[model samples]
Target: MSMPGLSTGTIAARLNRMPITRLHFRMIVALSLIFLFELGDLNTFSYATPGLIKYWNLSVSSVGVIVSASFFGMFLGAWLGGWFSDLVGRRKALIWSTAFYSIMSLVNAFTTDTTELATVRFLTGIGMQAMSVTGLTYISEMFPKDVRGRYLPESPRWLEIKGRSQEAEKILNDLETEVETYLGRSLPEMRDFEPVQQSAKVPVAELFSKELRKRTIVLSLAWIFVILGFYGFSAWVPTLLVQHGYSVVKSLNYSFIISLGAVPGALLAWPITDRFGRKQSLFVIMFIVAFCVIMYGLAFNETTVIIFGFLTAMLLQTQTALLYSYSPEIFPTRIRSVGTGFTGGLGRLGNVAGGLLVAAIFNAFGYAAVFIYVAAAFLMGGFLIGIFGERTAKRALETISK
Candidate 1:
């Protein structure tokens, strides 16, 4: 099933040497919009929870059940999305998942009862996670090893793996031509290299094989704890603030201000991920965010609460962006999506458990206890990755993962 002459190595070399062009910018813009929509939709239900509690007379337990349902859906979606992407191609998977979530989000607006709303939210979570998982994998595959990011165009590396070398070549040719025209000069000469031989299909069980099992465990644990900590704080903060005596409007406003910090937090990772290295940067951020979470919990005034909360949100998002880049790089091209998906799916389970944990801790021990629990999760996640994660910065995917 190998391409007669062309190989993955040649494709990679060509891609790696190409200079950035307007095409890369366009793809970045498109992928950023997709992520923006996905994150926005993912948080919609959380923002609506307080209003729903008042309007529908829903209890805290009911809210937990509803949030848990959505996360369960995300669990299924992450696994299926990765499997589907590997089976078909990233572009088709991305399109289908995006459409699925977008339509479901619209349907969510029409739901009236608790049962109806929960069901729709569950469906929406599937699409949201699917789109997110696919986007991450696509970004990892399409861009140079050092400059990960996405798009409509299928990954030439993926195409070559699927025995579509001719198509992959054509796409690469188009990219080369586009870059050449943009630069008003030909690209650097591409060097032919040995192709990596990959199976046409990789079974899911391969993730547990001797060579991959350690990676599987490490990545899964990282995803699970980080997600648990993130959702624990983000999903409950507004309601928790309201419970702590802030007006609903004031809580929402503070949440909005804290969220603005996320942009810069994510941006901060761009330079340091390569310079300081992914594992180091992520580890430092995670521990710092954990400390910030604890501080936010202990803050007695509006000013301290907002300040600490803003720091937590910013650093948490930085951790998120780094993970997206790190996850796919930990696997080979043949099983990249599935590997990322499997870990991410497990993380969704953590999200599910996080909801219940928040409700229980808040009900039994109060607001500060809940933040302490979340901080612990972040600390554990950081410890796992910092101690065990492979160094991936500035390394080629094949060299890093292989």
Candidate 2:
């Protein structure tokens, strides 16, 4: 149902030139809420572990098993969600995934034993990851190239690719009208641009096609290392502190205090990502975070631990936010979700491994060894992306992918 003269190129050009409007802000607010709940849910299990151990008498190894279960579920969810989104549209996929996780989280409260808890957690992980991958894909498609990090209706770009150009045109027309009404000025005319030809259907295996193979491998490895470091550190900090002889309440309180840095950390990326470019920003942040992780491990007292932990939390989130923006930009629209999901899913696998590594290392080699492993993970992740990732700031998605 494409309208004659309404090519994908025209849609892209119009979207690129559209001014930021209240509607865009509204969309950002809505999406931010989604991420807020998603992240809060992601850490709930980590926070609950101290209580589970005290009340249920769960062993540290048992806690690690539960953690791995959740990550395994996330691995499946990320891959499946991405594939489903491309097939059914981003809106539907997001809605389904969000609802799935929310219900599973509630179900989690009723579990009375380790087995039940692990099962529910695994299910919740799937939904959480699916929602995350879909939401990121939706953002990449709906926002303008120049300011995407800063802002969806159903993406006009996605619609056009799906051969629903008439609907895409209507959405663009509405957006333009809203922007013009808000500004009380006519927007500048769009420059001529070549249309990107749409593929009818893209198979998941296309991510490994000769044109994309290197990107897929490099990004997948980078994601694996980064996520391994992230989950290894964040998931274990509170539990480890308790094991180190701090009271459970003190560990949770300190973890919360350290977490206060997450918001500012994510916000700091907003300007720098556009200024320094995604690859460069990610590169610098990852290395800094690696050093912070080691320092956090070496701290001899509670104060130093909190300080280094706060710094680590902040920078870790900064890189995370940047990666969410960068990952979707790496693929063409036809397979953007699939590629993102695949890499992100592999990263979840890394988390699974991290959970086990944390347990094994903490038990076998003691405290400092665990941090060394986590630090090494971050360093590897940083080097991979610094050396191999594409520059994506201020560039059109189509241009970057090409």
Off by over 4 Å in 2: 1-4, 192-194
**What lDDT is obtained when candidate 1 is compared to the true structure?**
0.84
Candidate lDDT values, in order: 0.84, 0.86
Q: Which 10-residue span in candidate 1 carries the lowest summed lDDT?
A: 1-10
Among residues 3 or more apart in sequence or in different chains, the pairs in candidate 1 whose N, CA or C atoms overlap within 3 Å are: none
Evaluate model 2: give its TM-score: 0.97
Model 1 earns a TM-score of 0.96
lDDT of 1 by residue, 309-377 (tens): 999989988888888888988888878898999999999977887787788888999989999999999
- In terms of lDDT, the best-performing candidate is 2
Give me the runs in candidate 1 sitting further than 4 Å from their true place.
1-4, 149-151, 189-194
User: In candidate 2, what are the lDDT values of residues 262-368, reduced to their tens digit?
Assistant: 98999998888777888998889999999999999999998899999999999988999999999999998888998999999999987887788799999999888
